[model samples]
Target: MKITGLMVYYYFVCHKKLWYHLKNLNLENESENVGIGKLLDETTYSKENKHISIDNVINIDFIKRWEILHDIKKSKSIEEAGIWQMKYYIYYLEKKGILIKKGMIDYPLLKQRKEVELSDDDRKIIEQVLVEIEEIGKKEKAPDNINSKICKKCAFYEFCYC
Candidate 1:
């Protein structure tokens, strides 16, 4: 299975989510949080070349001058996941002979931006995560729900909790 950027992000957020998403049971469209995030992605970077897709594997929010990549986020509740997603983008592009200097994660609601750089070690970790995500796609059933605070805000909240 082709591991998209969303899979990489969900891998860090919750493996169960990643598994469910791979099985065509996505709930993002029904989530209020996702709607707000989509709005930000649409309105925040009105001038940039947005939603760059590569081999159906990675979808970048935007890139500035082919040097810096940008991704918009609703919040940083799972900041680590967001950071790894940026690193994965850099890694994927490097493999395609395109070198990105760094990635920027923008939280327009909070008026904050995070600079992400891919390191050699990060490349290795991202590769492993990609393999792990592929393994998730091969699973017969979705992984168990992670009863974390974020679950209450997830699109699958009602499906998993209520």
Candidate 2:
């Protein structure tokens, strides 16, 4: 199965979420948080280059100056996940023979911007993450939920909890 950027984000947020997503159990559309995020993505760069897709697997928010990849986020609440998601995109393009070494995450709501780079060390980590993601996808059942604080705000909260 092909892993999308969302999978990478889910991997950092919760392993169970990652597994469920790999299993094709999607709940993002049902959540207001996701809806707001989509709104931000659509509105923030409405007049700019946006929503460029590659091989129908990776959806980049925008490419600036024909090089830098820009990913828009609603918030920095889970910044790490967004950063890795950007790295994953850069890695994906590099594997496609496109040498993209940098990316940026724009948190319009928070008025913050973070630049991301894919290094040799990050390549190693991403390789390991890909392996873990493959294992998660192979599981027949989703992993048990851990009941973390983030669960309350998760789109799958009702599916996994209430």
Q: Estimate each model's TM-score.
A: 0.95, 0.94
Q: What is the lDDT of residue 12 in candidate 1?
A: 98
lDDT of each: 0.90, 0.88
Pull out the clashing pairs in model 2.
none
Please give, for residues 1-162, the per-residue lDDT of candidate 1 as tens digits. Answer: 778888899999999888888889977897888898888888997988899898998888999999999999989999999999999889989998999999999999899999999998998899899889988889997788889999988887777877
Residue lDDT tens for model 2, 7-67: 8988989999898788778888888999988887878878887899998778999998757
| lDDT minimum window of 10 residues, candidate 1 | 153-162
Best by lDDT: 1
Give me the runs in candidate 1 sitting further than 4 Å from their true place: none
Model 2 residue 85 lDDT score? 91
